[model samples]
Target: MLNFSATVNQTDLRLAIIECGRIAYERHLMTSNDGNISVRMENGQVLITPSGVSKGRLQANDMLVVDLDGRVVSSRPDRKPSSETPMHLEVYKAREDVRAVVHAHPIFATTLTVAGLEFPVDMLPEVLLTLGDVPITEYATPSSHEDAEVIRPFLKTHNAMLLRQHGSLTYGKNLDEALIHLERIEHVSEIFWRAKMLGEVKLVPPEAQAKLLAIRDAYFKR
Candidate 1:
């Protein structure tokens, strides 16, 4: 039998990805093998889910390990890295602080992308503080380096973004953090969609927005 105790961190990382997969599935954020997830491992390797596999049913042994340059270092014998590995690799290159990334087609957020509408931050304090502003990147074919480049600029300031006519990408320091970012994006997207159905939505005043920023800073600092 393989000695798993020696690879505890890698094992934990794999389990984390599997758990994230189930969470995304349970939340209905990913459907029919439509999303990808990845986590950075020590020594510049990245652990990612395989392509075309259902995220909801990932096994710890099914993950692929790749180097920083996107070369496959290890994986289950017959599995392959996600087709979107380039995109995830790009984010990792652009932000050392981002250790995990989640890309999904949550209906509400994807609807805004398809509608060509940017997610407006002014409507909610929590959205602003938790996600900053979710921008819409220019469209690019999935799994292309060009698509990765399109999202590079937004990665510096925003943890989440919509791919024009596509879906959303969220990243953070860990799997849970990335998932929370996705949740926040989906929540705000739902709010925006509902407000549109109800007609005009009012934004919080600028002064109050500033105060909310102050409160967020205080809490983050603590």
Candidate 2:
């Protein structure tokens, strides 16, 4: 499991969830009601965004708490758990270190998926150090049984990925980190897309890439 330097409580987590949902919305990561966010509590209950709710106006009380088995542990009719809860559940099941996840529909990232492109994030030092290779999950119907499975294999090694024909998924030890990745991916995607329009973009040489990765490993060692 991710060892948070500080213990995360339900109230704090709930607040973070609301704040990040707004961040996602304001950043245009998704249409107000398009994505899902979740945080795994210490007690194993999953707290998540509600279905069809506009994240811009989402509140703490508007969240739902569900068990790992996908059963509703605590909920309010005003806010029901998202249909994509299964996808978030699969992520927690696959990685004990992950405490929070952000599913967004950032335009640039989705554009890459639609164009059959994966962000060559390694081309930039900041991106190479913060995020390595960004993967794209196999195409699957959104919120379908296969959707979560399409990304299951990459969970162990990747912190973020593009969901084919869908959008993006980013996970981290907390909502703050998760949101950071959400922003970073979109920013990198835009850079790569804009750069390639002018001419062939240069890649970091293999020798230089190895050194940067070594530095990244040292800084982000789990």
Candidate 3:
């Protein structure tokens, strides 16, 4: 089991954050300094990416440790947590089960939001089972407490959301799951976009969608 004591060394968590950043950047989920990733330590502190740094180039030491209230507990002298820290902290506070959060401006997903489109929840069984009904949060000022408030209502029912005219936010029991959710969001968006370009997009039957949802709920129990 992982340690969560006040004195627990954060080396592993920092490395995980760094790797997540690198993967996100490489996969084009985030570019430049357009995204943030965080993992809540077992002790209730959070390790997050620093501000204004390319996620693809992040180093483990660039991670900042902060309390749930957004107070810095430890960080490199030159580093500061991402400006959207409140948004990340909100997920941790609202959903005790969420240990990691990822926010990114993925191309396809953000495009859907910019066009004011919602994910077709029953169009694909994989998406329905894995992500459920992806909600689009009302537009909120970036890096503000409003970002937190807008997403709070969906916290109990959704693991992934598209930020209106912004990007996407996804969280899970760990960094891996969170990242997977991020990737899946973009993947489904691209598929939907491509399908529209080809022809009418087919959807699973309502009966099948309901069955998949029941299975998903029973399995995730979220």
| lDDT tens readout by residue for model 1, 1-222 | 111222348878888888899989889899999899998876668999999999999998999999878899987779999989999998999888777899998989989888878787889988756677789999899877777889988878778888877788998878878888888888888999999999998898999899888887877521
Worst 10 residues of 2 by lDDT: 1-10
Q: After superposition, how far is residue 118 of candidate 3 from its true place, in Å?
A: 0.8
Per-residue lDDT of candidate 3, residues 1-222 (tens digit): 122233445788877778888889999999889999888887889999999999999887898999999999999999988999999999998888888899999999999999888887777899878888899999999988899999999988789999998899999888888888899999989999999999999999999988998998889656
Ordered from best to worst lDDT, the candidate numbers read 3, 2, 1
Estimate the TM-score of every prediction: 0.93, 0.94, 0.93
lDDT of each: 0.85, 0.86, 0.88
Once superposed on the true structure, which residue ranges of model 1 sit more than 4 Å away at CA?
A: 1-8
Clashes of 3: 0
Best-matching candidate per TM-score? 2
Q: Write the per-residue lDDT of candidate 2 for residues 1-222, one digit (tens) a residue.
A: 122333788888788887888878998997859999999988878999899998888877989999988999888866668989989999999989888998999999999889987778777888888878888989989877787889988999999999997899999888877888889999988888888998898888889989998998999654
Worst 10 residues of 3 by lDDT: 1-10
